[model samples]
Target: MTLAHRPGGHSAARRRALLGRATLTWPGLAYITAFMAVPVLLVLGFSFLTRGRFGGVVAPFTLDNFARAVEPVYLRIYAVSLLIAAATTALALLIGYPTAYAISRLPARWRTVALICIVLPFWTSFLIRTYAWILLLNSEGPVNRTLLEIGLIGAPLRLLYTPGAVIVGLLYAYLPLVVLPVYAALDRLDPLLREAAMNLGASRARTFWDITLPLTIPGALIGAIFVFVPSLGNFVVPELLGGGKTVMIGNLIRDQFLEARDWPFGAVLALMMIAVLLGAFAGQAAIARRINGTARA
Candidate 1:
């Protein structure tokens, strides 16, 4: 009998294909379930339970943890974290877009070199990088000494252990994240589109605003999320740069868990952070879909 003439042949093939696909995906699904989904569910469960007298979680559940997370002290920390994160994202966008644009416009042979320069810092440990910043931004560091010797200021400026230092640290660390995505977007863009716009009497600036910028919004948004999400929960940057003065939600969460031994409250803060990240991702996805639809139209 021919393959088509066999009654159950097509159905049997479809089943095999489905099974193959499932087999391929099982490892990833199992990893997520075992690590990500399970931990998140555990944190959610812990958020409701009472804190033990010493460290761990207790049996009886209560809403007090969530309620305490919204109090004035924690609210202030949230506000500060939001402001810092926003500033970091904005600065990264402004700086990274131009940088990515420049890199994208480079010769094909030179592009790889430029990209390597941008991402070279990632080869080192993040904690080591943060410590390097601490060295550069300290009162007696090279930055202040250079400025003093240059006669720009009377005395060495206190650059480290301040809010501005925290922002600087965040910007330095996350700038590469912004650049990579924007570069990818600009690199993939067809050169002919820009040429056609220019041929139609659109000025370079006008073409950028009308054609190039609009097309790269998705990439910019991706970079923004990359910087913003991590900046929001970053304790190390603020701790090392701000010198314990600037307390972000991340520091607060850490303190609750370790210092205070309040597991429930810490879990509550963690859940709040996760919720913010989820909301940001959802909003980005919705905006991306709208942009894609408009582009298609």
Candidate 2:
């Protein structure tokens, strides 16, 4: 008998397929709903609430917290955070692109080794790695000692506890993130394209610029976004390297909740960060679509 003419048999098969699909997807859906969606909703709801005199959130709703976020002091923090994040992303790109290119050109066996070296830092605790930087950049650290011995400086230059130090920390942390994506893009690239460009009388540099670089822009953008987003809200790097002098949005949010005892204000700041991140993600998506469209054309 045909499946349609088999009465309840068709219905039973359809139900089984539906059940199997639900079984595969439901766990992931539930996890996201419980963790990501719920927390985001809680933060959004809290942002409109009043802060209690002691610590917790209060009942009556208000916009005062958001208003306070726009005040000069907080705005200055936001500006500094943006500057730091931008600098970090730029530096990571500058350093990572060449490294990734070189790695991609290596023999297949060595390519794995190079990539492992790039990612090795991630195996350790991030906090521990930051502490390692403190040891390396401190006044009496090896960097300063080497410079002094070489007569490059009369004394230990103040490398640690500065905005520059914060940038260094960020670059150290996120450079690998930029390298991996760029390498993936470069490695996936067809070598025949470059050969064809050279056959057409294009110089090596010209081929790279016209043929390879344009194609890899999306990957570079992905890496830049990856580095920039985390660096914006990074409290640990600024706190450890910038030494409280460099207060970013992340630090400000922490202080609002813990020190100032203003949960609502903290929620507002957190929500603002989320808004900025969402805007970045949207921009990335649009740019990716344009790049893909260009590729298809």
TM-score of each predicted structure versus truth: 0.92, 0.93
Segments in model 2 whose C-alpha atoms lie over 4 Å from true places: 1-10
Specify the poorest-scoring 10-residue window by lDDT in model 2: 1-10
For candidate 1, lDDT tens digit of each residue in 138-188? 789999989989999999898999999999999988899999999998987
Pairs of colliding residues, candidate 1: none
lDDT of all the models against the reference?
A: 0.91, 0.89
RMSD of 2: 2.1
lDDT tens per residue, model 2, 149-211: 999999889999999999999888888999999999898788998999999999999999988
Measured with C-alpha atoms, the lDDT of residue 166 in candidate 2 is: 95
| Winning candidate number (TM-score) | 2
